[model samples]
Target: MKNSKEWYKLDAFAKTYSSIISEGRTTCFRLSVLLSEEIDTDLLKKTALFLEQKYPFYNSELKKGIFWNYLQHKRNGFSVELENTYPCTDVKRENPLKIIYFRKKISLEIAHFLTDGIGASDFFIDLIEKYLEMKYFKREVNEREVGNNEETNNLKYKYEMEKSSKNEKISEYSDLYSKYMKRVNKEKTVKHAFHIPLKILEKGQYYVTTGEISIEDIKRESRKYNTTVGKYLLAVYFKILLDKYPQIKKQIVIGVPVDLRKIFSEKTYRNFFINITPSIDPSLGSYTLEEIIKYVNNYFKIKITKKEFYKSIYKAINPMRNIFIKSVPYLIKRIFFPFIFDYYGERGYTTGVSNLGILKLNRKYSKYIKGFRFLPPPSKRCKIKMGIISDESKVYLSFGNLTANHEIEKEYFTYLRRRGIKSKISTNY
Candidate 1:
């Protein structure tokens, strides 16, 4: 163990989670930011230095697989095996941190294994804001929030805040629960990789808005309905799908990712999560909006819990002991993974949902960032991904993909509008 080079931040979740032979590629996103104020080069450098010191991973290596080890073992960023993974280190910090002066806007490309849009967005804003404040106001920054700030509510305080429902237990398993076990064992290579370019649209240009649902209102509605905020939105989409394509609702499957934080008390920096509990729309062909919402709610309730979450982790970790014992050659482990892991994500979900809850900008850049947006990776398998976020006052729903066809997505929005929830839809096709 002498040359182990163990750093506390070495993400065990990313390490262990990546061991499974599925979508070996990590989740990644790019952020483009425009500052309202002038940039401070010196302060920016100081900020990067502070981030490096504070989050030791900034100085690490990605030598081991994206999950195994990092290039700079203690660097403050994602782990990637450079030669193997294309666009591996999207957020290139090779140039001097002072390069902030040369660029008007910077794009931060990050792997999802490290942080979701909300998490990465939080860190990105914090780093820049802290740098500015340190240079101008000479104030210190505290990375981790404690005390009242420790409450998950304050996690994104600058935008808006609302209280979550008290924990509630279900008496019976939901009716929507399916009898089949969901696993990604099949692989199919897509003829063309799905790539969608982000289009920067003028705010409030694309859609008309009517009634607005506030953050408090959404949370309250979710609790009142005995469902989750995510499920509430899904309920909205399900109704949309049912109404728009009334003849096509034969057991439609909608997928939502379950954040493990709700189940585990442990804190780690990695993409360790699970998809929504799968259930068929038994009455899809004949169900009404209210019925669909209720079904989605009940199903979401049964699938998520500390017990089930742990069970998922357990199953993922100790895979095929009987077969793995034969020990595929090391060369096979390296070569066979890409084909196997990718096949897993394809067969894993009929559709995908990534809900990065309310995104509130830090106080430091409160004047700089007007609103936030998140678009997930669009693939042929999961042609559409719904990203939902709340700005304390209103919730934003968006449909993302590389395909230019607007009929499907437009239908989705039209359905939402019909449901009394007002929203703006933007597309970068």
Candidate 2:
């Protein structure tokens, strides 16, 4: 049977996130691969065409209706062009996702409403593999042997299931509320930590600086502190803030995005992550890097468990289930949703740090690739964001800034070097 044309409804997370999009916040996530040689533009274009057919859902464009915005399959074909503007620009009728070729780099920039990091990574790997096969071997890789061999390309929307027992839900809910109350009662105001000051860009420009470090050295340092790489880097971040702004007496909060796939075991390629803010207060006392790591480690142990994770999922979904909220019209919701988010969402965190984890590829394709780097979306409030990704031998830390200064990057890499981890810095200013 032939597939029929149909419109797909946006998930709860997508609906809430879409309202926050504006010229300032593009809500775009980028995944790019650096090849050993210059990219073949013609071949990349062909591969993109093949990919559009393979993953039809990605080819759809956003549409606004009476009730809400939905995705409608495009009648025309997709296009892959050279990158012309800054990362994470808004998607339109002609182009929903942009594929750009610049020298040896091929990047895929997708709207956050479409999918999360993991989902985008899956698609990106598949596209690279196909492109390589077409470029070198002059053939196609089998669908079954594609990236992860997971059925992430399916268009059918999948959501979290309320599989936990009633007792389990109640227990998790109570625990979550207890934690929330503790934070609220402990600190009355959301502490806005010090941000590195720089001359703001004109309109659509941003800055990107990258550092490559040895994974082995990072692991050794992390093991010495009895913590994971993510926590260790986060600790380093907190230390930098403390050194830069010595007068901040309150807590320093960092927004970390937690992947929900491990908790729900769901394979759908939509947004399925939550932000958890972990902080360390300077008022407590002067502390060393090890102490900061200890604080972060304990926080993760307490908040990252399966039970706590489910509590977050329910908290996000339960409001959407309310009959009253469902009855409200889209215009009213669109008008006020962003204000609610700004008051309760953006002000809580000093900055965002997302670790894309490790990258694995077939031996044949791995040798052709130089490395992988993930650049997070630019922000209006946070000003600077950090993204981490690693290959077999090295880890790449990319600091993306909306302002025009290298002070933060310089201090950060210098700190890593002082700790005996060598780093090489690159930039796109």
Candidate 3:
């Protein structure tokens, strides 16, 4: 059967990321998988092409529409490469999503325009499962005495076959949201924000640091704090920056991404999350870690609601639908979109906090895997951003730093260490 998932248009968040592609932003995010055994490149390559056909919705490239940018179905073959460069460093302007692999690691460095972490996690896990199955079966065959065995050949045929899926196609998920939620009328803008004053690293360089903490310990701590895991982590981030650099800015804004899929019960593979920046002021006076956690809990309780998400959807779509803005050509938009992106994006936030919840598998193959990591996109303004995800055992707290500031991560993990929630940390500085 032909793929029903046609690439027609770029979704809302896709358009935003696409416009800012030229402004020196990588705009790509990564979802990585670590396995117990080394990845077989040949088997993984076969698995990659097969999965691309099964999930043909992802076989897309960005192209120019008459007025705006659109996604076109790309038939130029899937890209699978060795992990040589920085993670999530792919330019998302015209490139399709890629699969990068090292010895025991496989990562999907995809554009935010392609899909959010939750949506793409399905594909990532499936590819790993399939690759592992194929590798083990081949090993079994090579060890056998027979040259042309019927039973072995039958299993080989099954693995080689490309099966088309009637269900789970991307076309089933609609991009339109006006039918479900009402739009918010207006909201104020942040004129000024606090950016970390750390000296930045040079071009093509990124600092990677990860901490492995027990899920039970972190959950216990969050419970102790009377908050959720995400809010608790956000509070810890706020407290770290405050403790380190308290005298600098009046306001410290942190952008928290709210997954809207759970809100409307829609499972669109495109980007559907909204950012709600919850901030604290140093000018009001210095505050303790507990105070910041309570403030974050209270702020999210009030601001991150179903209704608030709907308003965010409205604000995101309105400018694109504007009569005047719509009339402008793509050339003008290419030049002007960065300002809009910066104003509403990294410019207003001290840093970002995103916890991608848990790492769940469709199949019960967790034994063969080690863990997972969700790497967020980094920008010049938000020099160091955090991405977190967990499994049954431990929570992986990953911070991708673009500056020379090593103390931020040190202080963050050190605090967790003192709280009786010890974190096994690693870095690529």
**How many residue pairs clash per model?**
23, 0, 0
Total backbone collisions, model 1: 23
| Every candidate's lDDT | 0.45, 0.72, 0.74
Q: Quote each prediction's TM-score.
A: 0.63, 0.85, 0.88
lDDT tens readout by residue for model 1, 1-429: 012243322233333223332221224444434465555555565566555433433334334433243323332322212122211122332211111232334334455434445445556666656755775577754444211233421333211111111211121111111111234332222222222223422221222112224556567766766777777778766555555554542445565766664564433233445665354443425666567678776766776775555455544443423366225543455555545544644455545667777666656555654344444544445555666655656665556543444555666656645644445443333
Summarize candidate 3's per-residue lDDT along 264-380 as a digit string, tens digits.
666666667788878888877788878998888888888878777777777777777789988888888889888888877678888887788887774457777888888888787
lDDT of 2 by residue, 83-189 (tens): 78876654554466788778898988888777778778878888898899888887854553232233432322121112112342332111222222211112223
Which residue segments of model 3 deviate by more than 4 Å?
1-6, 136-173, 177-183
Off by over 4 Å in 2: 1-4, 140-199
Candidate 1 local distance difference test against the native: 0.45
Q: Ranking under TM-score, best-scoring first? A: 3, 2, 1
